[model samples]
Target chain A: MAILELKDIHKSFQDNVVLDGINLSVNKGDIVGIVGPSGTGKSTLLRSINLLERPEQGEIRFEDITLNLPLKGKERKSVTALRKRIGMVFQKFYLFEHKTALQNVMEGLITVQKKPKKETEQIALDALEKVGLKAWKNHYPKHMSGGQQPRVAIARTLAMKPDIILLDEPTSALDPELVTEVLTTIKAIAEQGYTMLLVSHEMDFVSKISNRVLFLDGGKIIEDGTPEEVFRHPKSDRAKEFFDKMNKLKEPEFFI
Target chain B: MDTKFSDYFSVKLMWSRIPYLVKKIPITLELAGLAFLVSIVIGLLIAVIRYKKVKILSPIATAFLSLMRGTPMLIQLYVAYYGIPAILRIFNSWGANIDVNVIPKMVYAFFALGLYQAAFTSETFRAALESVDKGEIEAATAMGMTYGQVLRRIIVPEALENALPGICNSVIGLVKGTSLASTCGIIEITYQNQILAGRDYRYLEGYVALAIIYWIITIILEKIFKLVEKKFRIPEQPKTVEEV
Candidate 1:
């Protein structure tokens, strides 16, 4: 069964239609890559999945539960419960500047889970250890490199024990050399069976990590297939054009 | 004018009143300190109300802040010292019979200063609150902090850092403003000096003394505020994830 589903999702800002009649599904433990040219509602669609930016109209079902519709009283509690299980990582590393790297990771455990301070600290430390940031536990985000911060950000969400992680252009802000560290961390997490919905521009990384790749154009999915099928043979004209542009752009060394 | 100046220059006359005026410095400091505390509490509440924009309460807060800021501080002191007492007295005569003297001159000064300062302080707080990045707030909310927890844990600490310099300036402004309370019979440093000048005719010496006091207070407060600003500076750290 699909772990997450967006049915007939529609979104717009003012008169400009950003996403119209878009639908998607991600099965459990699947690494799904959403790729599109810039300004194709890629970011908008990602934000909508988390309900960060509310959809104008649609049904989002995460783990078999419908979202986006107004929840009343008891239903609100259930929606909040589901939210705690979904984690989001932003392109800019959105780490709390005021909090130390460990503290940022521990925050979800402490605040959302209401885990004991000592246990939360241990869990946070464990997550940071996985990201190789256990030594920088007390260091603030401003002091860290972009790649380090993004790793810490991922650690933060992971500390919450979320089943699904939504990554919004995770490596877009990193230095070329630093991108591997973050991408490697993400790849490790994907190998560990964490369902991830990634919006990224790295064609090589997209081809490697994604169990399924969805090609979006003009706010709609123009193509969807396994990485080999989509990258080697495009079914849609838009998908073909996108791959042509990707081929012209040089790949980073890690891809080789 | 020369004769008037000499009269003001009477060293003996001014020197005699120095101890009496000096004695009142504590009273002035106490009034300012109390008013500062009161203003912070009042300002915080007004800020919260205005920040939330709670129905009728927000409009009332809006009007109160507008009237407090729009009018002169001196006028506010008069209304607090005289107008409020007279109104209370009139109400007492109509059967309430409340003892107006229970509320001292210092109390009136506090109410005037705190209420007046709160208007400006709340605006400062509001602005400081706005300065916090919206993303941090969302992150905090996502972390499961309730609105109150976010305000206390995330919003307030950051806002205080942003609001500190403004608050420090206001405190100094409040200290200077305490001089207006002398008009209401609080007998603080400014009032005592003014009285000494009137009786001894050493206007220049008394006025000069007050100027020195204000100067000292400003210098001291400014240093304190600068230290506070330094302490709150955002920590800059080196990033992780060694170059791949």
Candidate 2:
């Protein structure tokens, strides 16, 4: 059975249609990469899956629960439960500005799971250790670099022990040298067998890490296949053009 | 021509009022303090009501804030002191025998100041609440936190840090505004100054003394507010958002 499945998902903002008849399915332990040009609703699709953005029309199923619109009541409860099964990371690390690194990690455990302080502290510390931020446990996000803050954010989600993880351009905001460190941590996490959905512009990382690659253009999937199949030989003219353009472009050392 | 300088800066007049007026300062502070505390409670309740958009009551709260903000504070003081008593007297005449005087002038002052500032305080709190990032709230909610727990644990504390500077300024304004309560015979600093001036015929000195006292109080308050702001400031950090 699929861990997550979406069928005919449709959403539009004002007059601009962002997602039209979007369909996707991911099995457990799969790592899927979504790549697209700017303004192609990549972030919107991820947010819709989490029910942060309600779709105008669609069937979205995660495990046993299905949502046609944003879920509420028992359905919302299950949605939250499903979210616990899914960890999410963003390009701009959103750490609680007021909390220390350890406290930020512990927040979900103590507040959400109603865990005792001592136990939550232990769990949070372990997660921080996993992210190599154990020494900075007492430090607030303000005192850390962008890369360090995102690592803490990752630790925060990992503390929740989710079954699947989502990375929304996770390293897009980092400096070039810093991007490798974050991706290396993610690579390690993937090696540990966590399922992932990644939206990224890092074609190389997508080619390396993805079990399947999805190319989105103008809010619909243009191509979906293995990296070797899509990167080596392009069936679509748009894919060919995009790949050629990426190759021809002179990206700064820090940006790519 | 300048021989009547004693009339303007009479030590005798100012010294005589010192003991009596000093006693009255406490009364002013008491009234202002009580009113400020009450206003905070009323303001927080109204803010929470409006923030939640609680159906029928939310609009009522908004309208109440509008009325309080629209009218002059003095008019509100008069309605509390005079209009309320007159309505009570009408009830007394019908053999209800309600002694409206049982409610003192200080109570009227407290009500007038509290309700008025509550309107502005609610706005301050609303702005403070908005300063809290939406992600914090979402994170708490995903963790299975109830709305109340999220507010009490995460939202209110963060909002307090943001709102503190404005609230401190408002408290200083409240202290100055307490002078209006003298019109209703609350015997505050302004009232004592008036009484002292009437006896010694040195009105300027008495008013000057009151002005100095108020200035001192506010300067001290501003220092305290700065200290509090420095201590409680939300540290500037790169704002990060987690995806889950």
Candidate 3:
């Protein structure tokens, strides 16, 4: 089933357009990998799905809710409801520096959902265990490794039990040595059939895990298909050029 | 100016007045404590108003801050205490039913001092709130928090932690500023010192005692803030986020 559908999404920053009339849909348990060069609105496209960057023109239909066109100003009630069902992992990790890893994951549950503390504590712990960070649950984000922090971030989202998660350059912020560990945790989550929209530079991992890969450039999706089809036989010249540059890009030097 | 330095500088006399000034310390503390609490309440409201840039109210909050920063505290106290009553009398002349005569002198002093504190602290709060990483806020919202939840669970806590040192400064400034209330007949520690000095003709000695007391209070406060600031410190490096 199409859990979330976006139609005619357009966004711009001043004269630089970011997303231009994006139309896409995510089905339940689908792992959609989005790949593009820097500054091509890959992150912006993902953010717009969560309404983090309000598109100038778009229609987002998630389950039964629909948000039409430009988001007036601040977030609306419907947007908040939509966001609850869609979590995001940022490139910067953006963990609350003051909160311990456990507290960080537990915060959204207690504050947003108002779940009882005792129950949420156990749930947060289970989420931490899933990311293999239950041992460091009491450690603050500032005290943890880059790989560990993103796993905790993933655990935070996992605890929220959102329908779909938007991972914006999830491993980009990690040191090369830590990338595989973070990716491993992500892979473990993907195995459980969590619907995810991933924006990533690690094409090998992207091509391996994603059932479908989207090639975006100049604020538009140039190609979208199963990894075998898109990576091996891209039709559009833009997607071909994008792949050419991506092929030439320096490989991430993971010291694993 | 002609008096000998030795004649006025008696450590014994200064020491004797400390006990006399000590009794009135509570009054000074109460005024500062109450005013500081009220100021934070007002300042948070004003800071959030200005931060969010609420339509007409943003300019109003800005104007209020400008007015407070522009005027001297002494002048503000005079207006609150002396000028308000005079304005009320003018209202009576215009056949208006208003009475500022019933208001207490301490109320005016408190009103002025609390407002003064707010003006200063509002900048601290606004800056702290702005200084929080924008990405953290987006992360909070993405996790399903509404604006109100994001504020209480995310923004306000971060702002307060960041604003701790500034809050300490504002608190100390307000405590020292309560000395101005002596002019309004509030009989706080400074007013008590004046009365004590009058009894023995020891102006310099009594003032010295007041200074020592204030110094000690400030030291105690600074120590407490140092402890809190230490606790509030974002860890420097036990383990780095970059190193696996």
RMSD of each: 4.0, 4.5, 3.8
Native A-B contact fraction in model 1? 0.25
**Candidate 2 residue spans exceeding 4 A from truth:** A70-74, A250-256, B45-63, B87-98, B134-150, B234-244
The TM-score ranking, best first, is 3, 1, 2
lDDT of 3 by residue, B1-244 (tens): 6887668688888888899899999999999998998899999999999999999999999999999999999999988887778888898899988766677887888999999999999999999999988889989988878788889988998898889999999999988999999999999989998898888799998888898899899999999999998888766755322322
Alpha-carbon lDDT of model 2 = 0.84
Model 2's chain B yields a TM-score of: 0.89
Runs of candidate 3 with Cα error greater than 4 angstroms are A71-75, A248-256, B1-6, B94-99, B234-244
**Local distance difference test, per candidate?**
0.83, 0.84, 0.89
Winner by TM-score between candidate 3 and candidate 1: 3
Residue clash pairs of candidate 3: none
Models sorted by lDDT, best on top:
3, 2, 1
What digit string (tens of lDDT, one per residue) describes model 1 on residues B48-78? Answer: 8888788899999999999999999999999
- A-chain TM-score, model 2: 0.93
Best by lDDT: 3
lDDT of 1 at B110: 92
Show pairs that collide, candidate 1.
A143-B237, A143-B238, A144-B239, A145-B239, B92-B97
